[model samples]
Target: MKLTISDLAKMTGLAKSTISGVLNNKDGFSEKTRQKVLQAAEQYGYVPNEIARGLSTKYTKTIGLVIKDIANPFYSKLTKGVQEVAGEYGYTVFLCSSFEDHHTEKEQIQAMLSRRVDGLIVAPLLEEVTFDHLFDLKAKSVPFVLLGSVPGLDSSYVEFDDYDGGRQVTEHLLERGHRSIGFAAGLPTSRASRERLRACRDVLSAHGLALRPEFTFEGAQELADGVEIGRKLIAMKERPSALICFDDVVALGVVKAFQSEGLRIPEEMSLTGFDDIDLMIFPLTTVSIPTYEAGKALARTLFGRIFGGPDTPPQRIVFDEKLVVRSSVRTAAN
Candidate 1:
């Protein structure tokens, strides 16, 4: 046979409504009733029918999270923050990884909608992607907030100040009296990447220095990709004395490639990276984005929209990046 709420109510010798109150953790249930109902439910292996509960309440009490890649430590830390906050709100989260692909991102959103999730928290893969999916979300009345930018969209988001991050690293290298700096740039589609590049270029241009075409290499935000760029940079006839990697993941590969080519970091050529991720390839000098805090903030922002109404005039919060001065840069050698 099958078990149901009635069975639980019968086993606990409580009315069905009383059992329900305990199950939902509603405010009125007595402590004794709560304990008795919980014990019976566990003894009988009682599992609430989510579909029926959702139908009755018109809310599933579930949130969906879409990330670029779970393999990245940044996302792993961010998910922890999201889960902690969501748990406090009595909401369960469904996590999906888009792997930075457009079709996959769309599919994940569609799947979440089919489940009638109460809300969504998406870290959009905006590089070279159209905003049609976002427009679709608005059309379908799905409440969502971006974890990062999706250029030209007025969606509420929490993002790192990549422009300042890039400027800070570039300035640090320049302060060390290094002018011929190399840039290990990331995905061309990432606005964050572009922002960093523009800021660094602008800073260099202002100081009467130019980012030579030969000195710029594609970093691609991956370790192996960074290594390839590292090899290319090392082979250059006249290489920059310092390099700015796309991000820390790519920087690791760059470090390995450079070391293999008989070069030492901050000794022969200084290097900097972005996102001071834990377990970095080295004690790298870079800009730091607080991923965990960003995750917590993302959850809070999503709930604000869910309760405050869809037309609550979405809010945007851009966090500042800190310049972490590690042992990667050369004073002409800090």
Candidate 2:
């Protein structure tokens, strides 16, 4: 037979209320009494009835995490940080993938709510202008954070400095004396993709350099997409002296195409990437975001909202960016 809180209370010679207080780690219980109730419960092998406890407290102690895709190293690293912090705080994270789609993101959010999550942490997929499903969770008073910011939404978020990341790559190439630069952007609807693109274009414009339209490319954030873009660019008669890729994973494909066509890196055309995904063919020079630390911050922020009550002001944590210099780039001497 399973032991109950009543059994522990009887053994400890304490009232059920006192036992409840000790079990929940509530205040007002003396340390000595707290230990007495705890020891009695431990000796009797008392297991908490989570369902009953949730019913009484009106909180499930679970959090929801939604992202674009887990396969990407960036998202995977972020998930690790979230899982570590969530476990330490005695909470389970319910995860979902938006697949960068509005309908899918909405359905996943509804499913997470159905599971009675205490709060939500999402890397929302939004356009800079006119996004769908932006208000799905806005009406609810539950605590939530976006891994990235959304336009016209009043929620706390942890956003990477992707705009600066884009500029760093372009400026790195320009400072090396390469005037003809190119950008390989990811999905058009993705805000992350757009921010990076805008920064690169703006920086080029600042230097009185018009980013050549023919040298540019846009594709999925996939390895094959990288290879195709790389091939097309290398074949151009007036190709860009340097190509700034969308991401590290796609950059792998880009390198493969270049190597296949006997185009030596840096010696012929320079390349750079974003997100700093590990285990690459060459030591990649790219913009590195604090993925793990940001993940920890995201978890901490969500908990603040969960326990801090309705009046707690939202925390918008913006993470910094850095340029990881490696052997992948060289000076372009004209």
Candidate 3:
């Protein structure tokens, strides 16, 4: 025997019509009556048919979040932030992982749109996200907030100062007297990677230091990719005495390769990485960005647009990145 609205009304000794008004927040329903209805519904363990309610309200009060990789701790933190804020606002979240596949990203976005989620938070797969697939979402005027970098989108986003992070790391190594610095660049097609590489170049140029074309190798930010880059560096005749990796995962891989070669960190070579993910394993010199805070701010802005008021200026917020000095880098002997 399933409990329905009528059962709830009967259990509360209220008329069904009165119960309906209170449940839907209809005019002329006092807060006292609303509480009574809600209490009865809770006591009876009554679950409202939200599908029908969505048809009436034209909204599901649900948000869809898409991440490129769930295994990455950075995205996990971002998801946590979104979930925390979503809970605060009484909204439900539907999370999906694209696995860095553009095709999967397209399909996920379509499914979310078909379900008519109130809004979406997307971390684009690559720099060139297929705008055509997003057309239906745009046509429907669905609100979306971009989490990571998307070049020239002119949309609302919350991202880190990746360029500054790159420049800061490079300069830190340089200040420690490291002249032959190698770089483990991520996929150049990614906006975030591009910004990081640009910052590396800019900082090098600022100091009149020439960037060795052979020293700059691009790869995925995974640990395996880092190991591959490490092997290539180790095999060089005159390898770089220092390295700046794309992210913490790559840094860990590089450390593995270095250890395998019996090359000590900060003793024979120095290294720096970006995105200071859980440093408990092998603390590395890196930059820590407020990934979770960025997510929360982006959600706040998106919620504001969906429920707060009419459109305001396109909000572009960049969270600060700080350098975490650790035992990964050594002062190069002059």
lDDT of each: 0.86, 0.84, 0.81
- Provide the TM-score for each candidate, comma-separated: 0.89, 0.87, 0.89
How would you encode candidate 2's per-residue C-alpha lDDT over 1-334 as one tens digit per residue?
8787888888888899999998989999999999999888888789988767878888888999998889888899999999999999999899899888877887888898887789898887765544455466766776888888876787888998889888888888888898988888888756677888899999999999877888778755888999999888777787777888878887788899998999988788888888887667587788888898888999999999888987889788887778888867888885
Regions more than 4 Å wrong, model 1 = 6-43
Per residue, candidate 1 scores C-alpha lDDT tens digits across 1-334 of 7788998878878999998888878888878889999999898888888888998887898999998888887788999999999999999999999887878998999999999898899987755548798878877778898987676777778888999999999898899889898888877756677789999999999999989888887537678898998888888777789999868888888899988989898788888988889888588998898989999999999989888887878779999988999998887832
The order by descending lDDT is 1, 2, 3
Instruction: Tell how far residue 167 is off in model 3, in angstroms.
Output: 0.8
Show the lowest summed lDDT stretch of 10 residues, model 3: 127-136
What clash pairs does model 1 have? 330-333, 331-334
RMSD of each predicted structure: 3.0, 3.1, 2.7
State model 3's lDDT.
0.81
lDDT of 1 at 250: 81
Cα deviation of 186, candidate 3, in Å: 1.7
lDDT for residue 109 in candidate 3, whole number 0-100: 90
Compare the candidates by lDDT and give the number of the best one.
1
